[model samples]
Target: MIDMLVNLYELPDSSELYQRLEEQGIILRRANAYERHIVADWVGAHFSPKWVSEVKVAFSRQPITCFIATREKEVLGFACIETTAKGFYGPTGVGEDARGTGIGKALLFRSMEALKDNGYVYGVIGGVGPREFYQKTIGAIEIPNSDPGIYRDILPD
Candidate 1:
């Protein structure tokens, strides 16, 4: 995987994406501090323990850097910014059943918007999985030689 860079100032308006999700009964918003355990557990079950750790860090922030997609009070997806590092967007995942519902894209936009609100001109999509998705969605450009960037070192599950 490689890291990608996004120009926060150039982010496309997300109203349409958000509205689309709304029509499907999906709600995207920042994770509340009180929901820390629930969200962390959800991430662990749906993604990874490593991501659960990052989710905890996101909850620690004053404004909570994590955003979640939910419907009928059920978690569909999640995105975290400034978790592993500042100006970094990641550790996100949508439940397998929730794929193709635009949850991921909406979460991405919400995270990017939060990064912009945090006074960052550029945001890094650290350790990208689907390179094409990032490139196509937010105009993210690949960072040369970024494979394993900040993801090095050995640790076991």
Candidate 2:
């Protein structure tokens, strides 16, 4: 898993994607402090304990760097920015059942936009899983020699 870089200033407009999600009754918004436990638990169940730890960190920020996709009170997906490090976007996942609903992309855009709002010129996508997806969606470029970057000395679960 290599890290990728994205130019935040060049992010594509996400309004159309957001509008489509809205029509499907999906709501995208920043996760509130009060929802930390719920979101953390969801990430643990749907992704990994490592990601749950990162989600907790996201909740600790003043503005809560986490964004969630929900529908009628059910969480469909989530994205966390600046959790592992400043200007980092990651730890995002969509439920298996919600995979094709555009929730993941919406959550991604929300996270990237937030990074931009925080004065970031470029953002890092750490330990990317879907390399092609990032490349096509946000024009993310591979960072040479970045495999295992910050994850080099990670402790085992």
TM-score of 2: 0.98
Off by over 4 Å in 2: none
lDDT of 1 by residue, 69-144 (tens): 9999999999999988889998999999999999999999999988898899999999999999999999999999
The C-alpha stretches of model 1 lying farther than 4 A from their native spots are none
User: What would the C-alpha RMSD of candidate 1 be, to one decimal place?
Assistant: 0.7
Q: The CA-based lDDT of model 1 is what?
A: 0.94
**Tens-digit lDDT track for model 2 on 40-71?**
99999999999999999999999899999999
Listed in order, each prediction's TM-score against the native is: 0.98, 0.98
What are the C-alpha RMSDs, in order, of all predicted structures? 0.7, 0.6
Candidate 1 worst ten-residue window by lDDT: 147-156
